[model samples]
Target: IAEFNSSRKLIPASNTKLISTGLAIRGLGPSFRFSTRLGYSGYISNGTLHGDLYIIGGGDPTIASGDRMTVKTDSLFAKWTRALRVAGIRKIHGHVIGDGRFFDGPIENDTWSYNDLGTDYGTGGNGLCFNRNIQTFSVSPTTVEGKVNAEVTYPATPWIEFRNCAVTARPGTGDNLYQFNTDLAPVAELRGSLAIDKGQKKESFSNKFGALTCAWEFAKYLEKLGINVTESPADIDPYDNIRYTEAWGKDSTRTGFRYGNMAESPENLTLVYETKSPSLKEIAKVTNSRSDNFYAETLIRMLAKKRTGSANYDSCKVVIIREMDSLGVDMSYGAQIKDGSGLSRHDYIAPEFFCRYLKAMSASPVFKQWLYTVGIAGEGTMAARLQGQSESLKHRIKMKSGSMNGVLCYSGYVMPSPGKPEDDMIIFSIMTNNCPEGGSKVRSFIDGLLMRIAK
Candidate 1:
């Protein structure tokens, strides 16, 4: 008897994916798939894929680098390029065509607050997104000609630009930045240099930087690796292939490719490689565990299309609402969901209502097994905190933890005692909204509460 609702309505954080995912499982079923295909608009001669190489996206958000699906390495086109070159088709006089017509409406969420746009959380929903709209930059400090030299993950070409204002001063505290005046685009434009004091240790920072800007990068990576290309690609009408299909995780067991053989060397030919990402379960686990903003948002939008039978979010929201209604959960109260991962401070949800959803999840058999993995004590969001605590508690805690600036939330199942499993079964959702003490305090409090409950 936690009296969960008394804690207040909090921003859902990544817990929102739970709702989106549950709704997806119900509306789209467990076997659903978001697929991307390679289609030819031109003809082939001598086995050369002689046409505009079209990268047709079925709105699969799990494509390209940093997807962390264990198999979602950013070398699909590169591998395919090598495969094509081996198969003998070269000299493509066309542009790398990436098609993103699967979903409709503007890719970016218009309602997202202005403050979020520049960050990784505010990525665009484009027709073609590679690696969830991010690029990793590895920064290391070195001295160059008495000036400090820093190695950044710059584009392979001289096209993409960075301006760092780092100076070779005594190794100490200095902020290093490649401040671009404008947004990241596919086009290459290196603006300014760094301004960093040289004495500091070679600290590294990795960010999910850029928009859906890596499509060309992927394409370029493939082409430079000698993948045979036909011609310039033309966008296909998504309306032509819009259909309710089973969802597919990157590791579709039906496909026979192993998980880790994705690395490839790219050449100037055209090729197509199928990269396997981790299962949806793994993705969800990591998303919830890390409160990963980028992955959660991607999966949510993709889930919207999967559940609603529509690619647009407006209609997708309707589908989600209807699905939730089927479970006797009403959203009229403090449940306000503006985007997928509830990272938005605007997202609101009643802890009691969330608990109700958690209860319903417990009632489902298909989602039950996967359910525990996403929860606490299952090597997920709460694994570290719940370690050694679950054994003494005996209830087998499974939970999802969420937090933003001033909000913290948890929703999942717990057993009061091990010997009395049936009687011990309990579902709880706790949320702290606008806590004057901030999110860390609320989270620490939750940890304390869990430990107390365990004992």
Candidate 2:
């Protein structure tokens, strides 16, 4: 290594996924699936679910892409209504039984500091996660007023409250403090602000994230999808929103169902729904390719359930450590995987451990098939940096990039290296932590270096 800057045990940031993801693939195999079961307490008769409907969650993480981080009964209600309707059922006159038996851990990682959970970058493990278990809020400046009006993709009724102190500021500095605290989901929070550098007075806002206030939207979406309006639905979210509603009609049907029918026990309704876990490899790619923290957290929790028989991250740590040890990857490098997405700064990993993972994945056929194909400067995360560099460097680089507030890292295979002229496989891991410039700039710089190495 050339003259370096500072040398200490650094926070690997999302690079920790290199360890979690790689080991997850090796420990659980790339083909594993998270299972959710739909069981009935009574029988279906006269087009009505006679007893209660139990939507059991075995930690299926690939629910919704955004705003699903905090699961609202409404989003799930919509799917349930649609599914039940399709299955030749009309009314579910019973309680929506939430069987969270799969995960008995706290909503937030006990190891993670409280400050980070309220920031919205972190996620909670729920039997029901919609829209990727996160909510989105878009703010566009009103053409006339100096203030901006924001809209949630999934509109919530008792609606998610927001205190947008964000004003239309000058270019390069339009930022606001995005924060939320819910009586619901006490262990987690929805945070991050709408920052605009250059845009007209009007901009469309959207994110696949959950807000402490997403209950209103979920209710709205469900009603639209044909769920008979039912007294505004209960706010059963993990935030301070967990309240028991008086059981309707003696619990005749399942109200809070996740809507995914188990392969073994599909819905008893004539119109049952088949909810599938996005392939494990597909979810893995989202993290490696874009370093999606939400997906990473979800997958880690899901895998944690499989590994430790519990969905909580604490138990996940146990499973991850055990599996890592079983994989024969030395613990000398020492890593602490607080969450899958690496949003929690507590995540760490060594460089050689990083490279070892990449090389191992490169050798697996299933991984090779699911791993993302880089366009150099053509598309995806590498597109911007490879604009001029990737042209002559086609097919030479296939890698995953990761970043956090002040870090940047990349690890993957380089098709040809100087050492082996014909066809040599090269795996590299580079991470810079706690920089002032932020990780995006550092990521652009990393892409530039990778393109140069491709030649």
Clashes of each: 47, 46
How many clashes would you count in candidate 2? 46
List where candidate 1 sits over 4 angstroms from the true fold: 4-8, 46-50, 66-75, 82-88, 139-218, 221-225, 228-278, 307-309, 377-395, 436-441
Against the true structure, whose TM-score is highest? 1
lDDT of 1 by residue, 33-145 (tens): 55655543445566555544555566555666454454444456556556556655464544344556556665555566644553445555544556565444544445542
Estimate, for each residue in 1-455, the C-alpha lDDT of model 2 and write its tens digit. Answer: 22232223456766666555665665566766666555544556666656444455556665545322333454555665667666655544443444444555566665555545544455554655445455445566443325555544443212233445444544455544354443242222233333345353332222222321233343344446554334323323333222323222234222221222222222342224445565566567666666565566666676676666777767777777676566555555545567766666666665656665565566555455445522223445545556555354655666555666677666666776445664465566666777777456666676667665665
RMSD of each: 9.6, 7.0
TM-score, per-candidate, Cα-based: 0.72, 0.72
Q: How well does model 1 score by local distance difference test?
A: 0.52
**What's the lDDT for residue 289 in model 1?**
65
TM-score of 2: 0.72
